[model samples]
Each structure stands twice: as C-alpha cells, then as structure tokens.
Target: MTQSEFVNLVMPFKDKLYRLAKRLLVSTEEAEDATQEVLMKLWDKKKGIGSYRNVEAFAMTMTKNFCLDRLKSKQSGNLKLVHSNYADDRTSLQKEVELNDSLEWVGRIMEGLPEQQKLVLQLRDVEQYDYDEISEMLDMKPTAVRVALSRARKAVREQLIKKHSYGIQ
Candidate 1:
C-alpha cells in the first residue's frame, strides 16, 4: 500500500496501540517506542498488508506480543502497572479528587490480579475493545475472553466495595 493509504488505515487505531503498550509497559516513553516500532514493522510489510483480513487486529496482536516480550526481558525490572489516564475539566475539584482516588485504588487492585486477567480487563474495560477483537489480539476464544473479563471486573468490584464499605485494603 502507498504511504497515505497506510496512514489512513493505521491512524484510526494508533491510539489504541499506544494505550495497550502503555498498559503493559507502564512507561510513556517505552509505550511510545513500542508504538513506533510496531508502526515501522507494519510499514515494512506494507506490500503484503492487504492480505490480512483485519489489519487492526493484526496490529493489536503485534502490540500485545511486543509489550509482553518487553515485560519479560531483563531490562523490565523497573516496569510496573499504573493508571493515570483520566481527566474531566468540567468536574469540580472535589469530584475530580474523588474520581482520581477511586481510579488509583482500581489501578492498585488491578496490579494484584493475574496477568491474563489484567490483560483482559485492560483490553475490555480500559481500551473498550469488543470480545471478538480482544480474543483475536490475546488468542483466546470469545467465550474465554468474556469469562476472563467477567472475573476481572468482579474481582475489582468486590475489592473496591470491601475497601469502601469496611475500610479494608
């Protein structure tokens, strides 16, 4: 494909790629590098890109694998899960503070979850990917994706409720 065509195809989901990378790598710089690397890889394969039935899914899979590999590497010792990507300019300061605190607690709880559940939760809830897309990216069946997402949400909800109702961490 030509450069413009490639850009048109990728621009739609580029943010999604970066978000997934950030979710996995937990560093903005690392996520940016990963996104650039994935885009480069896709550009190199532009000649055959049309052959893929769903390039977005392929790119997402690439992003997922790339970030997972980075996490598994020796240099990943400093990486950790953190979620700070929320903003609401219209909200009052008190509301914003409360929202940030809740989000922070959710992020901490998510850190304690298993890797699969974490990934499922991030893909489904944070990234807003559909079941089929998440399944394709993570190589799980749709039903399996649903189950993982459900379990992840349930765990997060229960933990948040416990923390709020009984003052337990």
Candidate 2:
C-alpha cells in the first residue's frame, strides 16, 4: 500500500483502537502510548500492509499483544484515568446528561461481560462490524459470533432494564 492508502485505511480506526487499548490496559497514559506505538508500526508497514481484509484484525491483535507485554513487565494493578470525548448530537442539555449517565451504566454492563463476549459485542455493535467480519477477525465460526452477540445484547438490555427499574423507585 502507498502512504495515502495506509493513512486512509487506519485513520478511521484511531479512536476505536485507543478505546480498546484504554479498556484492556486500564490506563489512559499507557493506552495513548500503546496507540501511538501501534500507529507507528502501521506507518512503517504502509507499503506492506497488503490486503484490507485483515488490517483491522491484525491491528487489534497487535494492540492486545502490546498491552499484555507491557502489563506483564509492570506491576499490573488498576491503571490511571484518562480524559475522553463523547458523542454530541442531543439537542437538550438535560437529555445529553442523562444519555451520558446511561452510557456509563451501559459501559459498566459491558465490562461485566466475559472478555470474549464483551469484545464480540463491541466489535459488532459499537464498531458496526458484521458477523462475518467479526468471525474473520477473531477466528471464530460465524454461528458462534451470532450466539455471542445474542447473549451480549440480551445481557446489555437486561442490565439496562434492571438499572432503569431501580432508578424509578
């Protein structure tokens, strides 16, 4: 791939990669450094990135390996907090605030999922990757992806419903 092609391929994935890194390593600073290192590696491989089919898959694998390597070398407790951005489409400030709260709850629910399910759900829902794409990326059967997504969606919905009911009291 050419320089421009490589940039186009990876530009859209920056935030997703950062989020994944942050969550996995549980540190803002470390996540940023990991993302930077990941991007730099990609930059070096632009000419040899080859097919786009495996680009995201390969990138995610790299992120996981990098985080695990760093974590293994370090003390490995909870990581420090990092600042983040949010979606901004709501018209009302109150609604936006409420949405933020709801998102936090949802994120908590996601964190509670088994690691495999959580990653599957994030790729399928948040990243809008289809089952085939997820299967290819994770080396899972397509049917397994479907089952995991079904369970994940049900879990998220159930958790949200329960949280809402608790709130109404």
lDDT of 2 by residue, 69-147 (tens): 7756663544221212122232344653465477666775676676667778778888888778778766789999899
lDDT of 1 by residue, 46-99 (tens): 999989999999998999899888878724555333222322322244543354
Evaluated at residue 156, the lDDT of candidate 1 is 89
Residue 38 displacement in candidate 1 (angstroms): 0.7
| Cα error of candidate 1 at position 152, Å | 0.7
Model 1 reaches what TM-score against the true structure? 0.79
For model 2, the superposed segments whose C-alpha errors exceed 4 Å read 1-5, 51-53, 68-100
Which candidate leads in TM-score?
Answer: 1
RMSD of each: 6.5, 6.9
Superposition error at 4 for model 2 (Å): 5.1
